[model samples]
Target: RRGDDGTALDRLAGAITYAARLIAGATRRTGLREVYSPSSSTRGLRKLDSWVERALLEKDESLSTATAVAAEAIRQDLPPLFAEVVGRVLLRIGRLPRDMPDAGDVAYVPRAGHHMPLPPWLPPSRILGGFYVLRPIGTGGGGSVFVARRAEERHEETAETFALKVPAYNGAAAHTLSEEEFLRLFREEAGALLTLPAHKNLAGFVTFDAGAKPKPILVMELVQGPTLERLLDKRAMSMPLALSILDGLAAGLEAMHAAGIGHLDVKPSNVILRYPDDVGAPARGSTPSPTPVLVDFGLAGRKVRPGCGSPYYGAPEVWDTAAFGDRTDPRATDVYAFSCLAYEMLTGKTLFSGDALPVLIAAHLTHQDGPESLQWLRRHRQAQGLAEILSLGLRRDPRKRLTLSEVRISLAELGRKRLASLSWPLRN
Candidate 1:
C-alpha cells in the first residue's frame, strides 16, 4: 500500500513540474532523465518525490520552509542538486511559499520569452478606429489623449476640433465600461454643457461617440493654454494679474454651478489660460487677455461634487469626519483651491513645500499658519489693493469662505482699481 502511494506521488510531482515548465515556455530539452522518465536510482527517485510532494503540500505559507525541509530529508539519497532545482522550478510557477523570509535559498527564476495571454475582447488596431488621428498629445492613467479631427460634422465649412481620449493596452487585459453606460454619461455631459452654453472660459464638450467596437472617444473643443501649474513653475504672478485670471475662472465656475454641475477635480492642471492671438501675457495679463478655461471632466461629478482637490490644495474640510461623502459644497471646495492657486501665483512656491514627508507635515500641523502663504497675500495688496478681498478668501474655515458671486464682485472691483491705477495713461 505504501509503495502504491509513493508511485502516485512520483507521477503527480512529475506532471506538476512538466506543467510549470510548459507555462514558463521552457523547451522540452531541460536535460533531466529523472524528470522526463524513470531513472537508474528508481528507489532514490521515489524517495525524493515523496518528500517533495509532502513539503509542497505543507500548509506553511513559506515556500522556503517546505523546500529546506525537503532538501535536508532527501539530499543524501536523491540526485546531488535535484531538490534545489525542483524548488526553484516551483517558485517560478508563482507558488512561492509566503511568510518565509531569509531562508537562505534562491527562490525560482524562469527563462524569459513567453508571451502572456492577451484578452480576446480587445482587438489590436494599427491606428485607433472611428476617429482620424492628427497627432498624439499626451497619456494619462485611464488612456492616451490625441488631437483628432471630427469624423462627421453638421456643416462642411465649420471646422471642428476634438481631443480624443483612448484607453491604453496595459499588456494585461482588454475590457471596457459598458457601451450603454458610457453613452448615457456622454449624453448627460453634452446636455448639461449645452444648457450652460459654450464659452471661451470653459472647455466644452461637442459630442461623444462609442465606435462600433465599443471604445469611447470624447469630442471636446480644443482649449489652448499652458497649465496653471506650468505658469507657476516659471515665476510668481503680480497681484492684478492673479486676480484677472481668478476672475475669469470664477465666472466659468459660476456658470457651471448655476447649471447644477460641479467640477470635482479643480486642480491647476485642469485650469488652462488662453490669450488673444495665441500670445499669452507676460504675467497674469493686467490688460484684457483671452481668458482662463477649465478642462478635464473625466473626474467631474454631479450632485454637489465632493472633495476631489489634489492633496496639496485640498481644504481642511476634505479630511473632516463630517465631510464624508460627496455632499460638501462645490463652491467652497473651489474657493479653497482658488486660494491655493492664488497663493502659488504670487509666491512662486507651493503652499506646502519640499518632498511628500515635509508637505504632509505641513498639512497636519494644527498651529501652522504657513508664513509663505501670508507673503503672497501682502504682495497682492501692495500691487493690486486686494488685501481685504484675500483676507477672507484664504480663510481655512469653510463657513468663513466667500461665495463665487462675492468673488466675482470683488474681482470686478479689482479690475476697476487696476484700470484706475493707470488712470493717467488712459487720460493721455
Candidate 2:
C-alpha cells in the first residue's frame, strides 16, 4: 500500500510538471517570455513563490508531504521559476490527505478590526483556457478584471501582457437577468471589443478567447496608469493637463463614432491616463504628457438600450429607457457622459452625487444648469470659451449635442488660446 501511494504521488507530480510546461508555453506564445525566468522579479512571480513556500511549510504534514516532495523534485528537475509555478499548480489541485483534520472545524480568528479572510473555495486557481490569471485588479456588476499573461511561448522578443475581463457569474445570480442572459451579455461585450479596430486613444484589444472553458476572457493591453477617476481623487487637475486629456479622449470617441461604435459609458472611471514614456521611449528630460485612453466598452454598441450606463452620467433620454427604448442614440449618450467627465476634469467634482440611482437619474433628467464646479472655471475670463464648448456637448437635447468631431475642434481652439495666454505672459 505504501509503495502504491508513492507511485500515485510520482504520477501526480509528473502531471503537474506537464501542466506547468503547457502554461509556460502558452504564456510564451502570448509574449510572456520572462514568465518562467527565475531572475525575473515581477509581482506575479513573487506571489507564486510565496504561495509555494507556504504550501510546502504547511503545519499539516500529511497534507503538505505530497506537494512538498513533488515541489522539491520539480525544483531539481526543472528550471527554478518553472519549478515554482508547477509547485503552485500542484498545490492548487492537490487534495488534502485523508488523515488531515477537517477544514470545517478549524476556526479562523480575525485580527482586531481587520475583516476575516475570504473562504478558500472563493479562489479557484485552475487555468482558465490558456490564460493564467495573475491577480484581480477590479470587479464590477458586469465582470471582474484580472492581470493575466498568455501562457504559450511564441517567437517574440517581448511578451505581451494583458488585462483579462471575465464575467462575474457568482454575483450575477442575484441580478434581475437569468444566468444565461448575463453570460450572453458578457459574450456580446467580448465580441464588440474583438470587432473594433486599433486606435491610439482607445484601449488596445489583443484577443478574445470565447472558447475558454468555464467563462470567456477578453484580453486587452495592460495600461500602466491610474484611471481619471483615481487621479481626480488625489487632486484637481490643471487646465492645460485637463484639456490635453480631453483632446485625446475626444479623438478616441471620434474614431469610435466613425466606426459606428458608440461607447455608452464614457465617464472618468472608464478613462485611463497613460504617460507618453509608458507606451514608448521618450526624449531626454522630456516633460510627461499624459494621454487619455477610453476603455470599458462593456456598455458600448451602435444602438444599445438606454439604461445600461451609470445613472449619474446618463443622458436625459437614457433615464427613461422604457419610453425611449432603442430610439436612444448611443453616440448621444456617449457625448453626454463625455461632457460630465469633462466637467469633472475641469473641476474635481462629480456632476451628480447620491446614494440612490433613482435620485441620481432624476437629477440628470431635471437639472438644466451646468455643474456648480464649472462655475469657478467659467469665472476665469480666459476659460469662458472653454466652458461654452463643454456646454454644447452637455446639451439636454441629443439633437443639440455636439458631435465628437465638433467637440474635438472646439477643444483644439480652446487649447491654442490657453497656450497663447501662457506664452503671452512670458513674451511680455
Candidate 3:
C-alpha cells in the first residue's frame, strides 16, 4: 500500500509538471514579454521539484506551505501571470493529505485518453463574449475571478483589462446544486448588481453573460491594488488611513442600500484599494492616495439568510437559523459586518475567534463595546466620533442599527472635522 501511494504521488507530480509547462508556455505566448528567461525557467522547475519532494516526505508538515514556497519561487523568477497559473495548480494538488492512501488519488490522475481537471486559473478556449482571460485575481464562495482583456488587446497594456467571475465550486459544493440552479443563482446576483448605478467606491459592472455555453459569467472593472486583506497581512495602516478606507466602504454600501440591495459579505477580503490615479485609468508615474472599493456580491441579496456569510464577520441574526424565515434586513447585516471590519482595522485583531458557529454568534450577541483594544480610539476627538458612529452601526438589532446612508453621513462629517484640524500637506 505504501509503495502504491508513492507511485500515485509520482504520477500526480508528473501530471502537475506537465500542466505547469503548458501554463508557462501559454503565458510566454500571451503575455507582453517573456515571463521568464531561459535560465530562470530552468531554476524555477528545479525549485518546484524540490518543494514537491519535501512536501511528500514531511508527512507532519502542511502541504500548503510547500505550495507557497513553490509559488513564491515562480513569482520571483517569472511574470505574475505565469506565477498565478502555476500557483493554482500547486494549491489544488496540495489540498490532498500528505499521508492519504493511493485510492484517494485516482481522481487527480488521467485515464487512458482523458485529461485531468484544469486548474481554475487556466483560461478556457472560450471565456464568455470575446474576453480573453489573463490570470486569476481572487476566489471565494464557489467562484473564481480571472483578470481578462478584450480580444483586441495590446501585449504591453494593462489599462483595458477586466475581471471575470465564473463558477468554480470546491468539493461537495459542486454537487450541492444542479447546473441549472447554479445559473439561476448567478443570474439573480447579476440582476441585483445591475440595479445600482456605477460609483467610484463600488466595483463597476461591465457585462453579464447569461447565454454562455456552460454557465453565466460576470464581468467587472478590475481595480489595481492589493485586497484590504492582503494589505493588512503585510502591515497595519494609520488611524487616518483606516478611517479613509472605512469611509469609502460606507459610501459603497450606502449606494447598494439606496438601490434596495445589500452586500451580505463585507469582510476585508471583499474590499480592494486603488489609488486616486489608479481609478478609471492606471497612471504611469504618480503617488495618489488610496481609495477603497467594495467588491464581490456573491452572498448579497435583498434579504438576509442563514449560513450566507463568513462566520467571524457575520451578524448575530445571520447565525440564528430559526430567524431566517423572518424578514431580516440585509442592510443591518452589512452594518454589523462593516463594524467587524472596522474593529479589525483599528485593533489589528479579529473581533471574534472561534471554530464553532454558536460561539461566534454568542460573541457578537454578548460583546457590545466592540474590541477592548479599540477603546483607546475614544481618546482622540475625531476618533471618538468615529467610535460612536461604529457603536450605533454595530447594534445587534436591525431596527436599532444605523442605516447605511446615516453611517456614510456620519463618517463624512468626521472626515471634514479631521481635515479642518490637520496640518498643511496632511490636510489635503
Candidate 4:
C-alpha cells in the first residue's frame, strides 16, 4: 500500500510538472497582461495529499475503502481553502472571484439558498434591505460580498454598478477585528480603492455602504470577467490575450502605486478581464479598449507587513520577517508581487511550484533566486525595453526594484510603441 501511495504521488507530481510547463509556455506566448494564474496554486493538491496521508495514518477502514480518497477529501476540503485563497488573491489583484463551474469540481462560493445569517451584525432583512440587495458573490476572512443594486439610487452623473461587502458570522472574528475594526478596515479598503480613480484596468469604489451595520460595506464598480487564475486551469490563454491582460494589469498597478496603494496580493485570481460595456466604454472610434481590471483592496494598505501576505506572491523581502513596518515603503511590496504575477503570466505557472506548504515554506524561510523570467531577461541582455523594465521590477532587493512610478512610465512608453504601430498607415 505504501509503495502504491508513493507511485501515486510520483504520478501526480509528473502530471503537475507537465501542466506547469504547458502553462509556462502558453503564458509567454500569450503575453498575459494580468498576473493571475490558477495554475500558480498547489492548494488543491495539498488538500488532497494531506487528506490521503491523514486517512492512511488513521487506519480508518471506512475512509480507506473510499475510491480515490484524495479526490473526495479534496472536494470536501478544497472549497474553504479555495474561498480563502481566492479572497486574499482577489483583494490583491483588485477583482472578485467569479462562479466558475468549469475551473474545478469543487464550488467554493456557497449558493444563495445556502446563505446563512452571519452574527449580531447581519440578518437576512438587513442584507436584503441594504442600499441594493443582490445575492452574495464571494466570502473571505474579512466578510461576504454581494452583487448589490442601489435601492434609493443616486449617482453623481457617474452612476455605476456596485458590490457590497459585509462581515461574516465567525465567532472568533470578534476578537481579531471588532465591529469598529471591521468598519475601519472597510474605510481603509474604500479609501485605497477610491484613490485609484477610473481606469480600464482598475475597479473603483463609488462609496462606503455605512447605512446601518457597524461593520460597513463598500460600494464599488462591478467588474465583469472571470479571474485570470480560473482561465489558466481550463486552458492556456492565446499570446495576444495574455499580452492584453498583462498590459491592463500593469497599468492598473501603475495607478494604484501612484495613489499610494500597494496591492499586496498580485496573483492570477486578483486580475480580471473587464468588458467594454462594464467600464462604460463608448463603442466608437479610437477609444481605449476595455481591459483587465485589478480588483480587491481588502489586504491593501499603506504599509504592507512582511510575511503578512500570500506566500506564493510575497516579495523576497518577506523571507526576512522583520522587514516591514511603518517605515517600510509599500511600493517595494507591490514590485515583488508585480514581478511574481508577471512571471506567472509569462510562464502560466506560479513563481514557486510545489506542494503549497512546501512552496510557502521555501518562500518564507529560504533564500532563492527570484522568478526564472528575471534570469531569462538577464541572459538575453538585449531583449527589449519592456523586458528590461520587467527585470528591474523583478529584482530581489526591494531597494533595487523599479518604483511604481517608474513601472508606469516604462509601460506607457511600450503603449506608445504599440499605438504607433497601430496608427501607421500602409506604405504603398
Best-fitting candidate, scored by lDDT: 3
Choose 2 or 3, whichever is better by lDDT: 3
lDDT of 2 by residue, 1-428 (tens): 01211123333433444455566687789996543422222222323333333354454334355456555656654567766876787575345443535769756532211221222333365356677665555567556776666766222337666777775565323344576765676666557666677888999877776667777777778776657774565343555666778889998998888877788777887888777655431222245767889877656666655356776688877666555565666787788888887766765667678878778877777766455444555666665576677677777767788888887887778777664344211110
* Candidate 4 lDDT, 332-390, residue by residue in tens: 87886776675566446665556665577565345434544355534532234545676
Candidate 3 deviant stretches above 4 angstroms: 1-126, 151-159, 168-182, 278-287, 355-362, 365-388, 412-428
Candidate 3 local lDDT, 219-284, one digit each (tens): 888766657874555343555666677888888888898888888889997888876654421221
Write the candidate numbers in order of decreasing lDDT: 3, 2, 4, 1
User: How does model 2 score by TM-score?
Assistant: 0.61
> Judged by TM-score relative to the true structure, which candidate is superior, 1 or 4?
4
How much does each candidate deviate from the true structure in C-alpha RMSD?
21.5, 17.7, 14.8, 15.6
Q: Look at candidate 4 and tell me the lDDT of residue 76.
A: 42
Better of 1 and 2 by lDDT: 2
> TM-score winner among the candidates?
2
lDDT (C-alpha, whole model) for all candidates: 0.52, 0.62, 0.65, 0.54
The TM-scores of all predictions, comma-separated, are 0.53, 0.61, 0.61, 0.58
Candidate 4 has an lDDT of: 0.54
Cα lDDT of model 1 by residue, 134-225, tens digit: 54455554355666664454234455656766643332112333546545654464455556667667888666554535455565666765
